[model samples]
Target: MTIALRRDEAGSGPIVERIEGGGFRTQEHYFADGVMLTPRRAETWAGTHDAAMLDRAAIGQLLAIWGEGLPEFIVLGTGSTQIFPSGALRRALESEGIGLEIMDSRAAARAWSVLRAEDREIAALLLPLA
Candidate 1:
């Protein structure tokens, strides 16, 4: 299956326009694997896509998204399932004043589009759906 978003206007960040098996399509390019997205840029993530394998150090690196400007929150797209993170990881983000939101990759992609439309200060890690 494929999920798509309608682009009504231009924006700064790379919007998630389409999400399909094993990849995502943005206005800029197509990501064949997991991706990290910030309000400023999007890049390929070489880290583990399994949410169960994610740790504090893994998420902490997201702070480098825009080089010094941290996001207000983070969206963790855990592949095809909505795997919740450890309490320790959540607390760590809370201590840094960053909220953590977890969902399946497809949902996270759609959510990123909505939040970015409002110009919210956010970042996301989207694992491939298939």
Candidate 2:
């Protein structure tokens, strides 16, 4: 489904208006900027895409790079299933003052849209099913 703010609500910066595609797919469409991304082992921070996956090392690296504009929490979409991260990974994120929520892609998409609409500081790192 499409998620967009009203014309008047469109601020000066970029916003993830909507997300399309799910269910065992390797790619998803972001309607805001009209880009199709395949985050197989990657991360999408706000509108910035990266080639990182959900792993202990990757999570640590991401946390290191996260600066002042860090998200209050992150929504991790584990492909077609909800896969929780390892304890180490969870601790790492918590230590960095970031909350992590695990869910399937479909749920993640809906949650991300809702959080964005509420103007919350959030990011999504999704892994699409092969």
Candidate 3:
């Protein structure tokens, strides 16, 4: 996806123009900003994609990183398959008033791009197939 970032007249954050690539391979994601992120060990956060940070400690890490910028919901892509997180993890996010949607990486990527285009507060956590 080629997301174009346009600067608002008031100079707000760059607006996403396009987003591409949902299929995961080789353990890398090429973002619209031209940054290539390779996540290893299932505990990495690339942009909005978090691999296997489902534990309490890892969840805390996410809270720290997002802080006040936490989105209304998060899309978690479990590699090439759809795997739901433990109930404990789900409850944790729910306790924070955040919704979680689990899907495959491709679906998550597509949803993330669409939500972003609509200016919705959302995040994506994707696990690569490699």
Candidate 4:
């Protein structure tokens, strides 16, 4: 299934034009399986297509993209439905001063659109909607 999201022709990273099967389509690229969007860039995130594998360690790997410059929060899209992460994971992010916002891919895409338009300094990890 293909879910059409906000088409931001003028925004930076995390601008999702649509979400196709097992991937997301931006204006400039189609990220297969998953994608990571940082304040400075957006790139394909391999092996994150499964939302069930989301864990504290998984988030740590994703945060590697930030290096030392972490975002205020991370918008995490859990496939086609909202799947809450473990409390430990939430607390872990909080301890690191990073908020974890979990949502379905659809809502995540919309939120990303709004946030990107506002130029919010945030990062995102979007799992495919398959």
| Candidate number achieving the greatest TM-score relative to the actual structure | 1
Question: Can you write out model 4's per-residue Cα lDDT over 9-127, one digit (the tens) per residue?
Answer: 56676577887876888878998778888766677877656676677778766788876777889999988899886788788889988898999877887888888777787888888
Residue 67 error for model 1, in Å?
A: 1.9
lDDT of model number 3: 0.51
Write model 1 residue lDDT over 1-130, tens digit each, in one string: 7777775453458888888777888888888788889988888877777788788788755666657767889998998889987888888888888899999998898888888888888999998875
TM-score comparison, 2 vs 4, better candidate: 4
Encode model 3's per-residue lDDT on 8-125: one tens digit a residue.
3331222223334533322232432122211111224544234444654555644554545566877776765787767888888888788888887656655655565566666555
List the global CA lDDT of all models.
0.83, 0.49, 0.51, 0.80
Name the Cα RMSD for model 4. 2.0
Model with the higher lDDT, candidate 1 or 3? 1
TM-score of 1: 0.91
Q: For each candidate, what TM-score against the reference?
A: 0.91, 0.58, 0.60, 0.86
Give the higher-lDDT candidate: 2 or 3.
Answer: 3
lDDT tens readout by residue for model 2, 1-130: 4333332242222333333443222123233211222111223433222223345566544444444466688777665577776777777778878888888755675565566556666656655432
Candidate 1 yields a Cα-based lDDT of 0.83
